[model samples]
Target: MNAVVHFLILLVVLSAAAFILFLLRAPFWLILLVIVAVYMAVTTVPTFHTVYKSQNLRAIDRFLLRNYRKPIFNYAYNIGHGTDEEIRNSLRTIIDKSSRGDARHVYSALLGVHSGDGDEVLAHAGKINPGPLRSYYYAYGTALNGDLDEAGRIAGKITDEWMKHTIYAVIAKKQGNPEEFRKEAKYAEDASVGIQHYLLHHNFRKMAESFNLSQEGSSMMQLVENTAVELKDGRRGLILGVRDNEEIVQYDVELGDGEIITVFAEEVRRPV
Candidate 1:
């Protein structure tokens, strides 16, 4: 489509320039030179803009890494880009060296959940101040320790909707109820927004895959490659691609304004 547009644009420009030159009785060589110049300018401008945008994004990433300097930032980067062994090493180093805080507890709990080490999970769960968050960690730890019923009971007490639904989904997964897991997981996914959603999808995706949820081509998702869809917020976008992580499906949507954002399947709907 872009190629066709560019071709039509070039043809129109060249035709216009040739007509003007003919009216002025200019030489053929001069008309050809002007057409070549116009074509080069039109095509190269988009290339330049694309290259500048790519470089700008990279620069922003470098600036964040330099100034943010948080252990969690590094952990997020490693989770996205590193191998399983690298992620384990990064988590362990963060646990060993980072000062005790909620981030540390979260790091510990995720590693524990991945490793199925109830003791590791409980160790951090106890340090977290009593609240919905702490209850979630405890419930997850209990679930890891082979008490799905008790875990479900504990998770049920969490008041925060997203956290509550997420814990329940995990418990359902542990209990081997795929239907319950999918239902609760969708609730959690729907309640999440922005970066919190990103973190959940990335960190919990492997565990989600254990349920063998849905495929990229599943019509149940109602998503097709490059199709237009409406966001939950009523914005329209084109689906650039699908990130099909079994139980978790995210779409890279290019909005009408040309800003690309990642959103979970539940965050989008068929265009109205």
Candidate 2:
């Protein structure tokens, strides 16, 4: 838009230049203005549409960047495992262009959602994690047996490579920093766990026995309490999966004759 506006201004300036020349009966100046104006009009229209398309793409990219791929990594992990599904698959298909996470190439996936609607996108965010990673915050990692003094010390001095966020929040409180504790807690919470994330955290993890090949993803998400294998029907979890690259394995989270609660992502269309 800014470029288009500047181009129009340039045309007006050329016109004035031509008008001044014509006042002195100078030749070629008037024709110069006309050519500039015609070029500007033709160029601006298509550029405007291009800009409009870009804006739509940014809306989707903002949340999926390095600043936010943990969730998406979680999403992909889910889809690859049991929680992974058709909806998640469709979302990844939009890549106005995917530059392997480059900034300028973000529009590559702007139409990832097919339409510009915040509510729907947010809804997807919620379904992915429900309410942050609160459930994953267990006492064992903070301190054993809920012993405050020991727990406080461990939490205060935590520096684990894997669960840094969760451990740091504990340490922050021991240092008597409420602000630090809150901030770190949220980070730890949001970064809690996703099954697929752990599975594919590295190409090596996929080859290791720790990551089950049967689940088809990074099993690290299992470290956090709630992820791919969620409890269902007051009995067991409804683990999901893909069969021979063609079928969706489902779980019955809630089960009874007439009532059932199933948790899985649905596919959304990509925009043309």
Candidate 3:
């Protein structure tokens, strides 16, 4: 039986018992205690079943069920360290269970790209009901697979100007066309922060190369290390090292206030 149905039956039975006790002139406090106990059981049992008794839940789903918050950071951390099969299974679970929403679609598409399965991304995109955003994600998958022209054609179908410009900027960045990237960046400023940070990192490496210094051991590297940076969470930290993982760059930082934390590179910026 459904847990909710079971809870409703239990509630009806307890209410009947409480009513019988009242008619029999039992102590008011004792009847009230029974009612309270029934209420607590009804509320907690369903939650317990959802969190602990559900069968075949993926690790991420289990964490979400227990914590009641999307474990995005934890997922990223685990993906960075997990084996390929584990990562794929987790992503597949997320794609299957997440509700239809832009963020969910973006995550699914990105995971497909990260897993080097552009076809899967496009297949998922196609399954979404027809809409401009659906076309945009399909374009994004194509762009990730290095089909810039086709991606551009699909992006051109988007009616929302901001969405169109943002996706075009992504395609331009992937194509390594600085002029095109800048042109798209003008209209998509808010959407381009991460891409801009990635480009800035690339340019910094180029500058280091021009000066005949090792990219990892240059003056720029020293500056990045010594700089007191502000993280996205608004905590100030000094960068300890950068880990350029396959999916994203992470900065290992020691916060001035306390504790060591790993922040995404795009989230760590020098104080203005």
TM-score of 3: 0.39
Give the per-residue lDDT of model 1 (tens digit) for 236-259: 666668999989999987664546
User: What's the true lDDT of residue 57 in model 1?
Assistant: 27
Cα displacement (angstroms), candidate 1, residue 172, comes to 1.6
Candidate number that wins on TM-score, 1 or 2: 1
Tens digits of per-residue lDDT, candidate 3, 1-272, equal 33456567887878897998899899999999888887777777755664444332233222332232244433432332334565566666676777877557666766775576778789778766688768877987888788989999988989866568866876767776666665665564333332232222233334234334343322332425434455667666555567888988877776543356788878865531
Put down candidate 2 lDDT per residue, 1-272, tens digits, no spaces: 23446567777776666677778786685567666776676666544543232322222222122122344433333333322243244345433224454321222122222233323433333323322221112222233223445544534443442345544554554465556655655564345333312322322232223323222223454312222232422322222222222455333332112123444322211110
Which residues of candidate 3, in runs, are more than 4 Å off? 1-70, 73-106, 191-272
Query: Which pairs of residues clash in candidate 3, taking residues 3 or more apart in a chain or in different chains?
Result: none
Better of 2 and 3 by TM-score: 3
Best by TM-score: 1
State the displacement of the C-alpha of residue 249, model 2, in Å, after optimal TM-score superposition: 29
By lDDT, who's the top model here? Answer: 1
User: How many clashing pairs does model 1 include?
Assistant: 0
Cα displacement (Å) at residue 134, model 2: 22
State each model's CA lDDT, in order. 0.67, 0.36, 0.59
Error of 3 at 228 (Å): 9.8
